[model samples]
Target chain A: MFDVLTRILRTGICSEPLPRIETEQAANLQQRIWAVLGRALCIRQVDAGSCNGCELELHALNNPYYNLEGAGIKFVASPRHADLLLVTGPVSVNMEEALLRAYEAVPHPKLVVALGDCAACGGIFGESYATRGGVSRVLPVDRVVNGCPPAPPDILRAILEAAQGKRQALAAATAT
Target chain B: MAEFNATPDFSGAFANAGALPSNVPCRLIETSREQWLRVAEALRAAEGMLLALWGHDERDGGQGFLVYASYLTAQGLLVARLCLRNGDERFPSLARLFPCAVRMERALHDLLGVASDQDDERGWLRHFGWPREFFPLRGENRLQTSFPPTPEPYPFVSVEGEGVHEIAVGPIHAGIIEPGHFRFSVVGEKVLRLEERLGYTHKGAAKRFQTLSLAAGHRLAARLCGDSSVAYAWAYCAALEALSATVVPPRALWLRALALEHERLANHLGDLGALGNDAGFAVGLTQFSRLKEDLLRLNQAALGARYLFNFVQPGGVECDLDPKWATDLPRFYSHLDTELEQMRSIYDEHAGLQDRFRGAGVLSTATARRLGALGLAARASAIPLDLRVDYAIAPYDRMRTKIVTQDAGDVAARVVVRFQECLEAMRLCQRLLEQLPSGDIHSAPRVAPSGALATGIIEGWRGPVMVALQAGPSQSIRHCHVHDPSWQNWPLLEYAILGNIVPDFPLINKSFNLAYSGQDG
Candidate 1:
């Protein structure tokens, strides 16, 4: 216990600071959402159909470097309790209905962020005999983080952008 | 004792089994369909491990469907091929002799329209995604783009009793994990039975493989399972290299081994921490996750990819480690060693953690062997089978790997195995870096002749991952079967959770951490 405490003290707030949003519109929207929600955002992650590369990056958000929870963002177990839905991978045909049901279960005005290349434009495993393409094929995705597996910072930015209602601008910027 | 040669004559064992000269790790034998069961039985009786069973369509060439099963024996690897005459897709099922062949046979039936004579003919990989007539891997089926609407619910065997309540958990889980359905028949937290219905993540990987050249297939193979990307890529590359008779440089082989050990290290550290967190200790999760992140960042800086996906390619690796990074790797290991030692001490001293870990989910040795438990799970149960030692290839043959085992076969045993393996992997990385050779990193890609077959097997962190490759015209993949250790280990989880409380399921499951995507593909 002493070792852990001392180690934390030595490290002294090592979490990476949030990257600056280029657009004034995105910045203002983020500030407004923080003001309205008082800095707390609950997210529920759904794996529509993934190779688990995206999931690994998402899990790193909880690590000390990202410290997503320290920034008042928490991952919840149920979509009913979540304000945002984070979906990963191209929507497999078997998971299409389940993804839709999860979207329906979340409360109204739910923001959905698609993480990774697979969830963005179906990446390599495109619309095929077994897949229904990206998350947009099943749910209305507000933002799409691009990468085979997006880095933790990219994923964090997408979540924040989704919460701030600047998902369109975020998606447009990432698309290039 | 019989002398074990690299390639032995199987003609003496079976009358009609004709040996074919193929560029594979195993000796290829062509036999009639009637002789398949006899050969399989003979191999099993010789204590051969059934590595993979798959089938492919040959109707375009008028050769009908071909079923192949590969086995590993003391005499080395042996692959038996049998043709279903005149486009008749039915073949005798080897599942009766080898229980591990059950799912593979069903998968062949589902994807390739190959029929097995097994009693249980239910679709394995076909999870209502495509129509019954549309076999995805066959050359005839056109790939559909749209979604299937509201497929029928899978049939889970019902347990009718007075306090028998059923709990259905996910194709969408509560945690940030892959999608897999688990049905539990429980009476007040004590699980009577657990049935896993996976294949929700099936993306028709085999069909996709058929569309790519052998070089592009390595990328798809790496993505088959994220955590074991190195293993899959290396195995795929090995298979291609063997088929084309391309010898990878000694330095490239050493670097591949280093990358593989690093992959194992990252996964083991993450799993150890996750297991601790599942046992209700947040300290393990925090410390271990931090360690894992640091390692991943290091990997990113050194190898250009955090997951090491595109590093291993056909003939050789894509990137080579520079001298500076090579020297710094050992320093990184020392730092990690100190931190891991501290964490191990804490885990050992904590009584609550031990109570939750020990004896929670006990898988007896008898049950493990009977169910074909594999990799770390099998080692934890004293099975003592590791492909690195049993089927050594390249660098692994020179570097003697220490096999760790625990006879208890419980959660504690699994944890200990991970810790020990992590240390061993660290040692291996250090040795590989120290003995780093200066040579060309990759050899030129060689075009394999058409109608060639090769097999590559690697002991991935989870267990032995096997890739069987068959070349087609213009260097395209005719049929590539990527088999995960989960194919043999997933069934054992049902028995492992027989009497454990439902709450401990997460911890026990994390210990094994079988890949749903790998198995689904």
Candidate 2:
């Protein structure tokens, strides 16, 4: 127990301050994030058929440095609990049905973020007999983070943007 | 009867007929249909492990279809090719000798119209989108096609008993991970049998290779499994280099080694943390994750990418090690050593972590050997088949690679191996950095001789990542088969989980952490 404490003390807190995403919506995100998602944001990641580059970076968000959970966002096991679907990969034909089922399972006012170059636009494994291009080809993707795999900070930014964008869209519909 | 003696002889072609003591591998041996059976029996007796078994259509060349099997023995590597005429696409089965060949043969049936005489003909990679008659790899099929969905469910083997029930998981898992299905037959909490249905991530990499130039194929190869980007890229490059007869600069070779070691370190660190998290130890996750992040940060600062995707190319590595990297790399190495040591001791001493780790999902050495387990998992089970040490491929010949093994073959053993390997990787990187040669870090690229075949096998973090490249006309690729070590290790995961509780499945699975997209190719 003493050793654990010592190790923890030595490691210190590694989490950096939240990234400054340069956008009109992101500038006001800090003030309204809590209001938009109530208490926390729950994301369900569906890997359509990635090489797993994006998934690794997504996982990094949970580490002490990114501390995604500390910032009131966590990944859930079921799509039923999710406010957004964090999808990756180029959407292989084998995974198309399951992806749709997961998309359907998410509750109303859902946000979908395609998480890599493959999900945004089939990066290397393009539109083939096996792949259906990207996530947009199947479902309505609101945002796309485009690197071979965008960095963790970029992903965190996208998540915040997606949440804020969806909340505003719902408001617009009600006013109309 | 002249069997493959394994003394690799490399001339203009990979001459398998002659016997010579050479390090250059993928020694090609063309055998008759009848001779292939004899060769399989001989290789089995000689304790030669089948590295890869892939089938390709040669109808474009006015020949029939051909199946190639590459074997690694104590002597060297031998690639045996067997031909089947147009209509006669049947070949003898090697599943009796190497049980790992079952999945390969099944995939061969789906891709090319060739099959071994094995009873289990259930389609492995052929899902609803593929028609029964359409062989996608027959040189004339349009790959822009995906068939309509069919109403057929996969026949997963069931354990029928009084209390036997089933738990089905994923083509899309709950975790932020790759897709593959796992069917566990359990009685209450204890699992009786576990059968996996992979190939869900199959994006037809073999077919994609045909459309690429030999130079550009490494980009696709690097993403075979993004985690082992260095391994797949290196394998593809090595094969391309051999075919084109380009000797990479000594500095480039050293840099490649450095990148490969860093890749190994990054994966081991991540797996250790994930294993700890699985065992309900959050502290382990934090420390190791922090370590991995720091390493990746260094990679971005040095190699221009966090994942090292385009860092390794055909003739050599992409960028030379800058002076800033030379200083910062050593600093990072020392930091990793001290932090990793503290975490290793904590994991070793923690009774709760040990309790969950030890004796859970034990894959015996016998079972591992029989199933042809490779790389980290095989090493965990006390099988000393590291290609770096045994095959002495390139820079490994100079690094004085050490083989680390554990007797227990459980999750604990795998963890121990990971911890020790992380340190070993640091040691190797330090050596490569210290003795980094002063020369060009790349070579001039050239078109490979058409129809010439060769194999490049690298001891990747997971296992031996093998690339068998048969060049086409001009700069194009004829047939490229990329083989991941997960092919051998995934079957062993099924055996490892038997008799263990279903709750412990994730822990054991993380310990092995086999690749889906990599093996799907």
Candidate 3:
């Protein structure tokens, strides 16, 4: 316990900035997220046949530097409880059905973010005997984070953008 | 123990043993189908572990189909090539001798149409989407762009007798990890059996390799398994270099070692943190994760990418070490060394962690040996089957690598190995960066001639990642077989889970953390 306290004290808080509450862009992020989701954002990450480059970045979001949960955004176990479906990979045929099921299970007015080059646009493993090519082919994606895997900051920005986009879509629907 | 160090004694029906172009001495035997089983039998008797088994369609070259079985023996590396004539596509299965060959044979059948004469005809990589008629690897077949997936019932051997219930977990798991299904048969919380149905992430990496040039293929190999990206990239580069007989600059080799060690350190730190989290220790995750992030930041500063993807290239590294890394890396390492020691003591004295870790999910050395998981998986179980030590090449050959071994084959032992290996890797990395040779970081790219065959085997974080490349005419790749050590160790997890509770499954699984993408392809 003494060792733990000493270490913790030395470490201090490592969470980078909550920027305008964020990478790539962070303006009006925290307020926008709160106004939209009310309390927090629940993401269900679906790896639709990724090289796992994107997955590593996604995991990094939880690390102290990114502190995704600290920003009131967290990954849930089930799609049923999720507001956003964060998908990665080129959507292999084997994973196609699973991706669709997860998409369908997510509560309505859901936002989808394609998290890597492969997920955004069949990065390398293009249309072949196995892969179906990109997340947009099967699901409606609001934001596509590009890179071999867009850095964690970029991933967070994509997530925030996805939430903002969904809230706008919801507002437009109600106004109409 | 010394027997494993000796090259395989292939003394029987196969007298003609030639060598393949590789950093390590690898004898090759291309013989008739009749001697296929005999070759495996010889190697098995000689205590050789099957390295990789792959079948490629060479009918375009006016020859019959060929299946190659690479084995790591006492001698070094030995590759056995089985030739199946045009009309005859059946070859005897190595599954009888090497149980690990079962999945390889099934996957070979799925990708290339060569049928392994094995009783377990169940599909390995083939879910309903891939029809039996369409063999993706065989370039001759005119395939439809998309095959709409259909459901096919997989026969998971059911457990019986009162109160034995089964739990099915998915291809879309609960975490930010690659997709694969897990079927757990349990009586209450006690797990009876754990059978994995992988290949959900088969992005046709092998099939896609056929479409890439000898130069562009390393990029794809790097992604074969994301976590072990550098190792795969280096292995692919090593194979291409071997085929072309390109002597990579000494500095380039040292830099490649730097990237590989960074990869090793990063993975170990990540896993150690996760293991702590799995054991309900939040502080472990926070501290180790912070340390990993620091290392990743250093990697980005030094190597250009956080994950070190595409950092290794054919005959060289993609980037030169940034000069600032000298003080920056050492400072980071010093901080890490101190922090790691503190964390280790905290973990060691924490009774809760010790109780959960001590006897949970044990895999015996004998079982690991019998099952042919003598490399990465066996290392923790007091078996030193490290490729860096056994088949030392390049920087590893020079660095006198420290191979950490633990007698207990439990999660605790694996954790211990990770901690020790991380420190050793740090020391090696420091040496590599400090004494980085004065020369070009890469050699001039030379195209490997057509029909050149070579294998590159490296000790990845998970286990040995082997890439076997057959050069096609004018820089085209005929076949590139990427073998992950996960193939041998994933099954070991099934044994590791037996008698352990279902609740502890995640911790055990995390400890081994087999690559689904690497093995699936």
After superposing candidate 3 on the true structure, give the runs of residues whose Cα lies further than 4 Å from its correct spot. Answer: A19-28, A173-176, B1-9, B12-16, B142-144
Computed on C-alphas against the true complex, the DockQ of each candidate is 0.61, 0.80, 0.77
The top-ranked prediction according to lDDT is: 2
- Residue A24, candidate 2: Cα error in Å is 5.4
Give the per-residue lDDT of model 2 (tens digit) for B262-365.
Answer: 89999999989999999999899888899899999989888777998998887788998897777788888998898888898999999999999999989999
B510 Cα displacement, candidate 3 (Å) = 0.3
lDDT tens digits, residue span B138-214, model 3: 87763336776778889998999799999999988878888999999999999999999999999888888888899
Ranking by DockQ: 2, 3, 1
| TM-score preference between candidates 1 and 3, better one | 3
Cα lDDT over the full model 2: 0.86
TM-score of each: 0.94, 0.96, 0.96
Worst-scoring 10-residue span by lDDT in model 1 chain B: B1-10
Give the per-residue lDDT digits (tens) of candidate 3, residues A125-146.
Answer: 8777788878998888888889
| Candidate 1: Cα lDDT at B401 | 91
Instruction: State chain A's TM-score for model 3.
Output: 0.90
Clashes of each: 0, 0, 7
Candidates' C-alpha lDDT? 0.83, 0.86, 0.85
Clashing pairs in 3: A18-A21, A19-A22, B6-B74, B6-B75, B7-B74, B7-B75, B8-B75
Superposed on all Cα atoms, the candidates' RMSDs to the truth, in angstroms, are 4.2, 2.9, 3.2
